[model samples]
Target: MIWHHLFQPFIEFGFMRRALVVCLALSVSTTALGVFLLLRRMSLMGDALSHAILPGVAVGYLLSGMSLLAMTLGGFIAGIAVALTAGLVSRRTPLREDASFAGFYLGSLALGVTLVSLRGSSVDLLHLLFGSILAVDNDAALFVCGVASLTLLSLALCYRGLVSEAFDSAFLEVNARRLPSLLHGLFLALLVLNLVASFQVLGTLMAVGVMMLPAVAARCWVRTLPGLLLLAALGGALSAWLGLSLSWSAGLPAGPAIVLTASLLFFISVLCGTRSRLADGLRAFFN
Candidate 1:
């Protein structure tokens, strides 16, 4: 009885089930990380890190013959390396955090492209850029689930420290001693995991947008952190579902379609949300 709706897609075509599962996992995990990123005002880091991991993935493919675990590990290492480098540069030099991130990630992306061009075919490059949700296998799905569970658990355990650091870093610094830095490290680790899990579904380019845009849109409407997280997750999940359906019906690319749906929702939220500039202006004019 319960299988009737899902069975048509799952039983009729293996790709459909794979697509749905991959997108669902991506939505949940990415949105969860987006919450903390948004609060820290480090939202753009998602884009930077996504791009920064490209070279690592290319290297992984070259060395390991396209193993998902190897690629994910490579990407994870690259992301952490970039993060640590950015932190050091920001602390030691006059460069700001954003500038440092932009420099490192853009460089990483260019390097990745160059390396891929040297060894990989055009199709391989395209796959790395756009990704194939329907191609997700059991191993990839299990890996995503495992990462998501770990991310959720870590975030739950570090909630107090994370919230304090995000909202009031100085307070944590004065009272909790090492708590702020600890939370910061945890957030970075979660971001890396989310990127790894999402790379297969959204690719490096679209993953950041999917992770951040929904959270930004949700933020304009919700005041509380928990509410913002829940709304962002809902927005992400809805976008994933809509995007999958549309792509299936129209025979379009799933990754771009999903990102486009999320972008549209963001614009809608900007127009209709309570804290939106348009809404505020309208209210003032009416009043």
Candidate 2:
């Protein structure tokens, strides 16, 4: 009975099966990248970067009239621009990185909203902001898979540099193959790419949750950086499974349902992970 109820929806419906594949793939990329972001003390940057893509998406829609490829490409470029500009401003000016990120993201978001409003109905705007995952077609799914593959490959290549820069900037400057700035650019590129892909599953506004919630939940239970990434991947998988189950039964929006499940796991980890014994075991496994 338990197995039947749990697996029946997926077995009966192609959409559910596709959602599972995409969700699992998304979970891997976002959660793994999220580990780096958290360790680098840039957790909040996810929120800013996620919103920063809005203007680009809006411009793409305006120029191409809602072509998925156009909007995604535009958003990716815009996100990179915002990240680079913010980094530059923080370096040259008295402002901190967080402040600059906030300033740019706010402006970008306002511009995006205005542009979206000019020619689109509230429904169109809502779809962009909140997403419509059930409507995701094979083309969007293919794009997401491609982005996920690239993100993982890039992260693997930059692993040592990312860790070194995250823990010790001076040491990283001496050791990293490319300058830390180049690594930073690569990291932001991955961030924007994930956000664009996530927009298909969770909308621009909510996609950040997928990256954030699982990463944070894992942190509650782990001490080592590698342990954090592994546990975060686990948390993301759990969220995808539980969230899909809930959405199937309740007729809820799949994106929010997934995020909410992740949030619940975060709370559970916080409550149960005081001593981090489970995390210690995980660290040992990796070691």
Candidate 3:
């Protein structure tokens, strides 16, 4: 009975099956990246970058009217451009990196919303903002799976550099003059790619929630980097499964349901994780 309740949806419906695949893939990749982001104190940067892609997605929509390929390319371009621009501003000016990111993301988000509003209806805007995971066509599924695979592979290759840079960036800089910068750029590229891929599943607004929330929740439970990565992935997978189940049973929007599930897990972690390492880590992160 319990088994049938959980397993029947995927077995009976192709859309449900595809959603599960995409969700699981998305869960693993995004949460892994989220661990790195959290460690780097760039947790909210995922949120900023997620919004920063809006203009490009809006542009692609204006040009192609819902062509996934076009939107993905445009989003990638836009996200990368914003990341680079923010980095350049921080490097050249007195402004801090976070401030630069905030300014650029606000501008990008406004521009995107305006562009979307001009050409697309409110419904279109809603779809772009919230996503329609149940509408996963074969093309979308393939693209997401490919992105997930690429993300995991890239993370594997860059693991050492990422960790070294995260914990002791100056050490990495002294040892390998250009490696830090290269890793930073590569990491940003991967971040943008994952955001783009996630936009397909969870939309731009809610995408980073799935990425960061599970990682944060995992942090509450574990102290080690590997433990955080593992727990975050499992949390993400749990959110995907539970969210899909909730949406299926309640007829709620799948994207928000998934995010809400993550949020629930975060609250649970907060309640249970008092005095845990997460409290100290978060304090340090914000400070």
Among all candidates shown, the one with the greatest lDDT? 3
For model 2, how does the per-residue alpha-carbon lDDT over 76-140 read when each residue is reduced to its tens digit?
A: 99999999999999999999999999999999989999999999999989888888776777988
lDDT per model vs. reference = 0.84, 0.88, 0.93
Candidate 3 residue pairs in clash (backbone atoms < 3 Å):
none
* Cα deviation of 64, candidate 2, in Å: 1.7
**Colliding pairs, model 2:** none
Q: lDDT (0-100) at residue 19 of candidate 1? A: 77
What is the Cα-based lDDT of residue 188 in candidate 3? Answer: 95
Runs in model 1 deviating more than 4 A are 1-11, 277-287
Model 1, span 1-287: residue lDDT tens: 43543245566887787777777776777887888888888889999999989988999988886789889988899889999899999999999999999999989999988888988898888888888777888888888878878887888888888888888899889997887777787788789878877887678888887899889889889998889988998898888877876776677888898898999999989988878878778789999
TM-score of 2: 0.92
How high is the lDDT of residue 94 in model 2? 100
RMSD for all candidates, in order, please: 2.8, 5.0, 3.9
Order the candidates by lDDT, highest first.
3, 2, 1
How high is the lDDT of residue 186 in model 1? 76
RMSD of 1: 2.8
Model 2 global lDDT (CA atoms, 0 to 1): 0.88
lDDT of 2 at 107: 95
